[model samples]
Target chain A: MTTYTFEPRLGTDRTALYVEVQQFYARQVRLLDDLRAEEFAATFTADGVFAPSPGLPPAHGREAIAAALRAAHARRFGTEPVRSRHWYNMLRVDPGPDGTLVTHYYTLVMVSRPWDPAPVIAPSSVVEDVLVYEDGELRTRERRITPDHQSF
Target chain B: MTTYTFEPRLGTDRTALYVEVQQFYARQVRLLDDLRAEEFAATFTADGVFAPSPGLPPAHGREAIAAALRAAHARRFGTEPVRSRHWYNMLRVDPGPDGTLVTHYYTLVMVSRPWDPAPVIAPSSVVEDVLVYEDGELRTRERRITPDHQSF
Candidate 1:
């Protein structure tokens, strides 16, 4: 068993920091559910990385992340009354010694199709994210999403 | 969006406490993987509650929790060469105002069947747990397990 430890700088308000980190994730999920892929990618740093799964290649940089997100949601985005929604919750935030924040949560993806009365849900994914606060704004440095089911 | 706020006592060693909490969870997963159902239930307080899914009645008390765990794993527990293994990861631990720990994580359950060379994985579940330290030992107060796929 490996023991993990962290020592935040003196006078750091951990409680407040935790709240801010949660809010950031809330906003990120909202952007994706609202079909704002560009905005969702902007939540990451300029040189951020996004991995959809463990064995897949990651998308590097803001532009690449945006492109990948768009491709993933192309079907929903192309249809009328976009119905894809992402629910993220139970976030745990940890501050790193090197000015980074690591957090993890489970995300549920649902879609409401025209033929259905309500949303059809998909299996959830666990997301592990590394973030950095730059210029008074928190941005993701890397996000690794591991889904329950493997398509490929 | 709602903002959650909690203020722990000013002099607590949160980082060290966090490590202890993680170790507790690690021990819990290990117990389950090793077919220690009774021991796993012992990790909870005497009056603990374990809920397998949303909208389901929770198993109350240590004895009941133990019974429920045994029932859930009956197939594997009764068979020879037990193949059930639980992989829990991406834990987030938080301290409550009244000396409790709230944590969440995604769990991947896999089974190594005699017919297959690789393990067959089940859909992940996100678990939310509340724990408290009693008599100098950490024990679970409540546990809620939410599976990714809902069977209607």
Candidate 2:
């Protein structure tokens, strides 16, 4: 059996920073999953830019982010009661210029309803986020998402 | 909207340890998903105990763990060409007595094939793990998995 070494891109010494970012995502994803648009948007900076994908227009600013999320929620679920979860793994954190953190991770969106026997897993995607400290708290300054299917 | 705070059980001071464990799982889960039973078991201590669920018997020691994993993989996949991914979220890490770390997290097992358009999401589960440092490396000493459906 071949032994695989766990070598992180940013090295093991950045555990504290990595954990901080992970916790940030933990809260951000939950807000989005719960459809708390305002709260979700608050996780980003006032002028944060979210480019969902190459084909879609990016949402700029917290207000636009909140509106886009609410619109997407309404269009997707409508009146149906459903629970959506965003699961992340294989997170990579790197230092960026100007004291920002560049993070990359795979996200799997799971959607299920009370009557459903199993949850539906959306096509996985990789997200690149530029995080910055705003008012002593970490927040997303910019985000770019690339779907797995589209990457190839 | 009511604000939700991200209060971790271990507090923010323990970010370094939390990230260390998260990285550990990143590698451990891949070994299991890829059917590298021996490699997966190596992430545990020599006398690690894994209780998969209440209905199943626990596997004690690395050898037993590896054998159990291999048997389960063969039973589930057989000759089928399927890909399995384990996604984790909502991880909580706490300090345990005797210089051990306790971790709790939710796990979602996703299975898919080359021909399948969407992956199937298994019932989510909560895993409780006790980790200890062996030879300056973190390893799992005990793990207990509780399926979400069985909790109630």
Candidate 3:
């Protein structure tokens, strides 16, 4: 995987924070591709909560969230290593009142198998996330995806 | 209209133009309310075109387009008053390639008779319009409405 250079700020040290988000995404992509335990654990914080924009329930806690992702991946992509794509449109990213929360606007489009060759759903969404910093590493305290379109 | 004073950009001139859009809206509202017209015109320039962001057909032309709107008003609204509450978010009215085209972000939440409380089937939409200026009047060169949520 090639390292991309995109520095989004949520207050505090910019460089370290930027690397953290990218690394998180990298681990996430690997976990999604492999559907393995260790990779998933590495990707998300222990208390990570995931909410797919549409057609899924709110997945809370690392194990639950990771399991949900794995199940969904298997259901769609099947046994063959699932290959996925991510599209994020940058609208506005700024520090929220909590100081750690970064609010941003984005549109996420995802496709899976057995359902159709084409994408299952694509929705424009906005998220507010609390980026927690501990031991020189940044992880998400909470991430809330709001008012997503439901077509999947 | 209580004439709320905003910046020059959001003044009477713009509202007047929007009022014109409201008039265009009225034709359909009137139709839904069981009204007819001998001749009604909402013309865009030759190069005018509508962009449907979500899942609506985009149209162009003068008489054809006007007739289309009239027909739509007839079918969709059908002589019922549209209790529309619209908020025009981003409207950039300036000279276009041919004449004038205005681009804006709009959220229209309205209720028409027979469907007074149906959970807003047609959710608030994001709209962009290309307009034509003629004889000190604004005409729609093109009108595009991209729905926030679409079934398909």
Q: What TM-score does each model's chain B reach against the true chain B?
A: 0.82, 0.88, 0.50
Quick one: best lDDT, which candidate?
Answer: 2
Clashing residue pairs in all predictions, respectively, total 0, 0, 10
Q: Report the C-alpha lDDT of model 2 over B1-152, residue by residue, as the tens digit.
A: 11122234434457667777879899889998998989889989888999988779999999999999888878878988988999789787777777678887778888999988888777666689988877667788899997655543
Candidate 2 ranges with C-alpha deviation above 4 Å: A1-13, B1-13, B20-87, B90-104, B110-120, B125-152
In order, the candidates keep a fraction of the true contacts of 0.00, 0.26, 0.00
Say which prediction, candidate 2 or candidate 3, comes out ahead on TM-score. 2
Residue B90 error, candidate 3, Å: 23
Clashing pairs in 3: B31-B79, B32-B77, B32-B78, B32-B79, B32-B80, B33-B79, B33-B80, B34-B79, B44-B141, B90-B104
Candidate 3 to truth, TM: 0.38
Measured over the true interface residues after superposition, the C-alpha RMSD of each candidate is: 8.6, 3.7, 15.3
lDDT of 2: 0.80
Per-model TM-score (chain A alone):
0.83, 0.88, 0.59
Score residue B103 of candidate 2 by CA lDDT.
85
**Winner of 1 and 3 under lDDT:** 1
Question: Per-residue alpha-carbon lDDT of model 2 for A25-46, expressed as tens digits?
Answer: 8768768877899998999888
Better of 1 and 2 by DockQ: 2
Q: Please, what are the lDDT tens digits per residue for candidate 1 over residues B1-152?
A: 11223234433766656656655665576576556878998998878889998867899988898888887777444654545546677888887656677899888775554434344567689999987876667788889999988634
